[model samples]
Target chain A: MVENHPSQASKFKCEVKNLNFYYGSVRVLKDINLSVFSHQVTALIGPSGCGKTTLLRCFNRMHDLYPGNRYTGEIELDKINILAPWIDPIEVRMRIGMVFQKPNPFPKSIYENVAYGLRVRGQSQRSAIDETVEQALRNAALWDEVKDRLYDLAFNLSGGQQQRLCIARALATNPEMILFDEPTSALDPIATASIEELITQLKEKVTILIVTHSMQQAARISDRTAFMYLGEIIEFDRTQTIFSDPTHRKTQDYVNGRFG
Target chain B: MTIDNLHQLHRLIARNRFWEKIFIVFGILSLLVGIITLLALLIDMTIDGLPRLSWQFFTSFPSRKYEEAGILSAWVGTCLVILVTAIAAIPIGIASGIYLEEYAKKNWLGDIIEINVTNLAGIPSIIYGLLALGLFVEQLKLGRSILTAGLTLSLLVLPIVIVTTREAIRAIPNSIREAACALGASKWQTIWDHILPYSIGSILTGIIIGLARAVGETAPLITIGALTFIAFLPDSPFKSEFPYISFNWLQAEFTVMPIQMFNWVSRPDPEFQSNAAAAGVVLVFMTLAMNAIAIFIRYRLRRRIKW
Candidate 1:
């Protein structure tokens, strides 16, 4: 069992309070409260349609891209309510990056894929962009494979390399946090292991909020785990506690492979 | 479980296979019917017209003497008009497409506009010419010149461009937009940097196809008062003086390939029929070339893009 540290409360990077999400007229997420610690991975594990992905998207206001989706709640990042009406979702997104389940590299060169976010932030200097692209690629552990052919089309990369390229893309902007929505769901087992290892290493630099369907994946990478059932967090505790000694019967049943 | 039952099921499978074979044969026959008709017409046109194709046939102006007549004025007019059509239609069509697909709210008004845009493509080409006659020629006083004809064709093909642009843009997956937006890019940034670049190849294919259709059009140009016989070319768009460019050619009188062909075919001279056939060959080649270019571009661009 991982011991509870006294300074854990001070490391709170994000706090979600009484969050409710709606897709048009349908209420998708119920009142939910959760806390994410700085420089730590917090995994949300739930069955399909349990609102895990929706809650993760709320952190960056991704629902704003589509029409009729709505959110009512406070998602505070660094004590700032990112969900405030006046706060531009674009601004919020800039500070918090996201990697999707599928490896969706742009139809562009590998270098351009990594450089896109920096370019979006108006970083026009060629040297600065080059440096950041290299650093981000190295950080994602994809530099060695693609460094020699950075100008090749990103689609040429293998599935694993493409997912890592996506990770590198998300990391280029130096975002405060990164969201992973089943980032390895589409990858093979070997690729999934590499991605899981990379995510564990990534928590040393940026806070992570991952929504995973695989309970084993959550236990493997996350320091803290939140078991969500029916749009609500059923249990929030250390990964060790959630798997070995969960207070909620739902969490126990889910982690034991009995039910989801 | 009985042998009699097995025999009946075998017969059913055999019947389905027979229908499948019949469908394959019918599909090939239908395809060949269209191909053979086009090939026969092309062969006949070439047999009559290929002998007449020469440097002189391309460079000389129209004349009463069919042997001396060439398509210089007609071809030049067609080129300039197409240039104008491309310029006027491309930006407007693509912008409208982007606005409708990306920016417009999904509502009753948007739905109505979508249906109207689609219906516009089905409208007769003559209607566009008449509308242009009233709007551009009379109300705007643009005169029966290349500018007027080009604008008329632009309006005629605008729906084609818009529809195609929308289709190309729609083919880009939703994940691409999400990826761009997730990177904190503004809506315009996403479109300009990613959406436009990805969809440009398909959009260009649509534009060339529209232009090819515009090239073969006759009724619209005729209604717009395009001349059938012309002895001189429009003034050069390039100049020797400062600024070195001119718009005078836009306002000059013009004739197109179809108009010239029509005039020859209607003439009482047997020799003029060969000239018309020659013009028909060139027109068909131009359309075919444009389509080939579109196909080539689509092939090249699509090779690098995968979902």
Candidate 2:
């Protein structure tokens, strides 16, 4: 479906070179060498605990929260060493925003929720924050549902709406890359379609990296797909090619639902 | 006898049942005694103390001849002291709770602090008084004064305040903290802006309960050496021998309700015994009122916090 998209021919923007990760004594991700093109939705698909979530977290170093979690080698964003000791994990996270599996909104009003990131980095003016919150919400396709109720507590919103609000909460910071970890896993079909459409739309402006278990969803939304098995990537290629004629037998088998 | 011999093995089981029922009855009867004793004590105090309760108890000063005097000064002193102690404990306790829960790293130092705080909460009140005597009185030279006694009580109740407050903070889900964190707020900013407001209702409830204990404390204040009789209030904590200035924050040699009640009970006058009962009633009401307020707030918070 990507069909001659000019940007698809571009070389790697984010290179993962012999990147390895571990938690305590167990390795969650083997040496993974791949490249994610800029402004493309490269979906990582695997069985549960196949290191899909772990690899997604590696993009922003969010895995640091887990005890004894460690990463080796390089995940380069624009050829800069993101995994090296010199980088601040917080700053890397700032550049790479994230949304969790569950919508975790603060016990705050919608406006406050979106403006919170800005406020923390020390933005005080009312007009500036208001404009940014509005812009972020509009970008996430949540402004139409929540514009009139911006002052209401975010928990009052429906689950799908809350997830969008969380997306807006992340986008308010204006990060270059956004990570979605099963972003639509908790939503119904209608909401899932809306989020899928939103992510496809979002890919035009912000580079996206998503982890999902749904094979149909991976084919439907992503431009490129990576099949991972037991912490190792079995294949990575154009989505259409991978689905139709996968190079690796395991990759073809996984896409055909013959095996996971 | 041959037919009954096969059934003889179950006889001991029936005997065991009899003793089990007896022990169960004994446990029930033991609990009954405590409940009845409490009810009797309440009834006796109400009957004996009701007659002596009047404006006289709230107006006159204590006298050496107990028949002519009242506990107005002691009552006023206890109120003033507890108020000050609460004012000091609430903020420090809540801040420490928030810090321990939200910011403290999971490390040996944090574990050490947690263990020390738990141990401090279990220590006897008299030990707190001794600690105060050593620190505030001898080392700092605050003197054997009302301020010193009130501080001793504060220190005695502080550990409970901290422990309860930390529990209240912990009851909040980690998802909430993560939400705030994902907002790009720094750790302290997230705690200050979002987490603290949600946890305040429970923190205040713990504080009110702490205040109740602080107000009812008699041993620590006695250990800090409060006077049973002071005709006039002192201006400053250092001015124990002064022509009474009646200041609120600083106090020198003042009697609280329990100290006064103990002094009155030890008196030979049948009249003083009745007054002690009245004082006991006042003490119980103060604690009960505070406890009721805390419970009311807790209920309202439970209903109000939708998430």
TM per candidate: 0.95, 0.87
Q: What is the TM-score of chain A in candidate 1?
A: 0.96
Docking class of 2: acceptable
For residues A1-260, write the lDDT of model 2, one tens digit per residue.
Answer: 33335656444568898989998879989999878877889999977778888898898887765468889989998889899988876777778888888888877799998998888778999999999999999999999999999999888999999999988988999988888999999999999999999999988777788899899889999989898999999899988988999999888788899877
Cα lDDT tens digits, model 1, A1-260, are 11233544457889999999999989999999999988889999988889999999999999999999998989999999999999999999999999999999998999999999999988999999999999999999999999999999999999999999999999999998999999999999999999999998888778899999998899899999999998888999999999999998888888898876
List model 1 lDDT by residue over B1-307, tens digit each: 8999999999999999999999999999999999999999989888888888999999999989989999999999899999999999999999999999999999999999999999999999999999998998999999999999999999988999999989999999999999999999999999999889999999999999999999989898888888888889999999999789999999999999999999999999888888889999999999999999999999998888889
User: DockQ score of candidate 2?
Assistant: 0.45
**Number of clashes found in candidate 2:** 0
RMSD of each: 2.4, 4.8
| lDDT value, residue B182 of candidate 1 | 97
List the candidate 2 regions with Cα displacement exceeding 4 Å. Answer: A1-13, B1-34, B65-68, B103-105, B234-248
